[model samples]
Target: MTALPDLVLFAKYPVPGYAKTRLVPALGAAGAADLHRRLAERTVGILLQAGAPVEVRFAGAEEAAFRQWLGDGVRLIAQVEGGLTERLIDAARDHPHIFFGADTPDLDVGVVASARAELQNHDIVIGPAEDGGYYLIGMRQARPELLTDMPWSTDAVLRETLRRCDALGLGVALLPTLADCDRPEDLARWPQLEAPGRCA
Candidate 1:
């Protein structure tokens, strides 16, 4: 069987007032944290079922909690102290990797597989998110400069990343855009959350 590509799922411990803070006003701190936990669990489940080489790089949580949450067969790594860009750059070094956020509930394993395949022909692959950021980013090698001093969490993220790719002479493959639940309005995208007691 062909070796699976490296897949890194970025996450944070579902601590109230820390995780998913953007939605705290609408969902309350505890509610938002619950949502974060469910989303991370769901995304991890999808990747695990895909049977790819998967690892979870997490912040604010103990390794034991993650092991128990994700179950066996998945590697867990603690995120280093730094901004998001630094952490991501560190994870991408020395190998081709698909790094994804836990917020994208609509993202599936097939998209991840496609990214791995795309890396064979391109130096980078990015799945754009509806929020103007990206849901996933994959690269054949670490290019920290591409992500340095970026306008993170802004509408410029995707555009800036593409510009950086051009400047670095890296060929990029674009995947279908998806939605990430961040604000209260964005919750409408996930109909399952509308049901009573779901993601409560």
Candidate 2:
């Protein structure tokens, strides 16, 4: 039998003060925590429904809170202690892993399936966000340099990652762009996106 493709997601415990810090100003700490929980659940549900071998790499100061939110039958691991780039590069070392931020509730399972399919033919696949950052990144193998010195959490991230791919002569595939629910304006769309336990 063929080995199942791995789809790893990066997540945090959705704590009040430490999660989604960028939107905390608009959402307030508690509200931001709620949003993070809902988004993480939706992302996990979608990936699980897609029938992929999914792993959620949870990294944050609060491990117990994260453990409680995780349901049964999913692989959970603590992210290696480091900067964002270091953790991601470490995760990518294992499989043709795909990493996502916890904020993109609009990401569909088909996008992930498409990414895996493309990985069969390409070295790297990225789902670009409308906000100038990428929503998804998948690679056939870990290329530590791709994550080492790039400007993260900025508009230049996707551009710089692509530049690195070119420098290494890696084949690239771009997926359709999507919006991430990271700001006050994005809250308008939350009503339509399903959040089973929330007022969606």
Candidate 3:
């Protein structure tokens, strides 16, 4: 007699010099910003095709710009405040959601399908990225402790999150490893050819 929860996709406004900081040296701020826009659009495109009731959670100062960029079919919510942990905790409190960065172009439909399937049984689901962080994370239930006091934007993030899951006795499912377009070197690892592969 309980209604199933909704899925929310978290992202940020693609502001130049602010988004994708690691790739800026190789891509320049403008180029990196352009890439961010493309990445977000592609992610939303795929999620839209998945045919689920979904909303986009934009985290940053420019909520208006993000809303304009994302446009239609997405209900926009400003992250308001929180580090990654706080924002995610807030999101999970409202929905059984999955959050993914805009950087992973290779997150195919099958992988997303697998995540939704796994969510049926698991408390949390993680899609590990080739870099130290994860591309996607989903939770059927909110466990704020799993996200607190952990390093963000490091290779240790996924490992530490898993550790917290263990500490909290939460069941987690793993999705296939995908490449996150963080550093300049990650461009080669991307499966699609939407643009020229820029390297270090």
Query: What tens-digit string does per-residue lDDT give for candidate 3 at 129-152?
Result: 877679888887677776788888
Assess candidate 3 and give its lDDT: 0.75
- Flag the better candidate by lDDT, 1 or 3: 1
TM-score of each: 0.93, 0.89, 0.86
**Candidate 3: residue 48 lDDT (0-100):** 74
Kindly provide the TM-score of model 2 when superposed on the true structure, using C-alpha atoms: 0.89
Q: What is the lDDT of residue 89 in candidate 3?
A: 74
Best by lDDT: 1
lDDT of 1 by residue, 98-166 (tens): 888899888787887788888878989999998788998888878787778999999999999999899
Q: List the residue pairs that clash in candidate 2.
A: none
In Å, residue 198's CA in model 2 sits off its true spot by 3.4
Deviating ranges (above 4 Å) for candidate 1:
1-3, 194-200
Clashes of each: 0, 0, 1
lDDT of 2 at 102: 70
